[model samples]
Target: MKKIYFFLTLVFTGIQVQAQKDFQGMAVYESKTQAPKFEGMRANRDITPEMQKNMEERMKQMLEKTFILNFDKSSSIYKEEEKLDAPGQQGGMRIMMNSFMGGGGTFYKDVKAKTYTVDKEFMGKEFLVVDSLPKLNWKLEQETKQIGGYTCYKATAVKEASKTDFRNLRPKNNDDKKPEDKKEDPKKTSGETKTNFQDNFELPKEIVITAWYSPEIPINQGPENYWGLPGLILEVNDGRTTILCSKIVLNAKDKATIKAPTKGKVISQKDYDETVIKKMEEFREMNRGRDGGPVMIRR
Candidate 1:
């Protein structure tokens, strides 16, 4: 009886230690965005081959990024790894280009609590967008692949156009007019103007998202707004961009410090998106009548 009791106690203690070890870890993900060619924009511009190459490289540098996901069993904090610019390199057009691309943000997800928070910056202002985790109707597939030595299973879902994606669809302003600056015209009333903008600016209805998850790492966590899977997502491709796990360190000597972002204007995700659109419209209005202004590049 004493020998059996001792064995059971050892097994239970080992299970407890393993469970604790499974939840605390960090993952490194590399994101690559395959932006469409700017052939239409270059058609009218006097862009030399060298200049085109340089521009493309700069754009790639901006889009291709690395992120770290520090996670426990039920919560995770994902943040971009900052890249230092080359010495004396100016961010002239690249900065403007990034504003249109609209992505870099820190995301926090709590699966247990069904909550999420995003630390986003727009036009030099920080916004803490808090909201519930988006529920995805993922269709599990029989397909399997290995990512960073982990056997990952395939899952897919459809989601609405993200705020970054919506920014790309903003219609060009005919003329920058402040709401207070313009007098009411019979032919072009406020309602008509709004209708015209809505006609021109159509948001994408659905975005196909493909994710590969590993059951071995049994954590329902992923980068950005993706979650609710039965396992840890190792790779995700949402049409325009792909984020893949390059490295995962489990049970390290030092645990990653995962915390929700506290500083920024508190707002819901919907409100934050509206704020972005409003600011973008204001920028268009301010840049009205300016020659050689920022051109929208379709990707």
Candidate 2:
């Protein structure tokens, strides 16, 4: 009787574990970013209140976006829910920004493998960026909150900020200075430097990202490049941007295809970053002029 009971317990435990591994779900996220607010504009010195309001409204419409995450126990696929482009955004610049900043591609994460793959489309070219996933040292906190009826615990991480992140983009303080007023650098070997890439591409060295995850889901996954949590991350605040979970469905019959992209020019993440930087510098040189006008649009 004792041996029979032991065998039955083992069978029941295996079934329970198998049930946990079979859990699959789909999560929808709402991501948004704030418009650039200059100090001069607030004082109405650089622009009128009416103009500022219109600018903000237009940018808000462009920045508000949505994403979807399909996940099982060990791997997940994240991608933006396709939407029509905003007016005046049907250009190379917008597409490049999206491709570079984790927007234009289908992102696939293999938690067990500790790797990620992104199928990015930039400026009419395709790239399959594959690299090890970012290892975030999540500092779990005692604080908890409710999101979409699930209790979520708080966690924070300090990670290196991307240089190409659109939030870092802003007009330089001396952008309106006259060409005559600017001094030339004698040490620059590339003859007369048309534009200074270093001065214009400033960004925070690091950013503190706060996340809220729910243990009820028991899945270590999140939207975009965010993961490595004890549970499913429902919300994330990265200073200038926020991605929040709006809805979730568990074990849906129509499971999303959670596979890594198989086509494109294969490149590591580091090489891709360097490629983007090089192209941006080249563009600046091409558009630079003697009139001291903007080589790149502020918006």
RMSD for each of the candidates: 7.5, 6.7
Q: Point to the candidate with the largest TM-score.
A: 2
Task: Give the alpha carbon lDDT tens digit for every residue of 1-299 in model 1.
Answer: 99999999999999998877565888999988875533323332577778777777776777788899999987899987877777655765545555466555678899989999877667778778899998999999999988878899999998887664533354434366687866664434434332222323444567789999999998899887788888999999987689999999887878777778887899997888788778877876776545544333332
Q: Which residue runs does candidate 1 get wrong by more than 4 Å?
A: 2-18, 40-48, 91-102, 166-203, 294-299
RMSD value for candidate 2: 6.7
lDDT of each: 0.75, 0.78
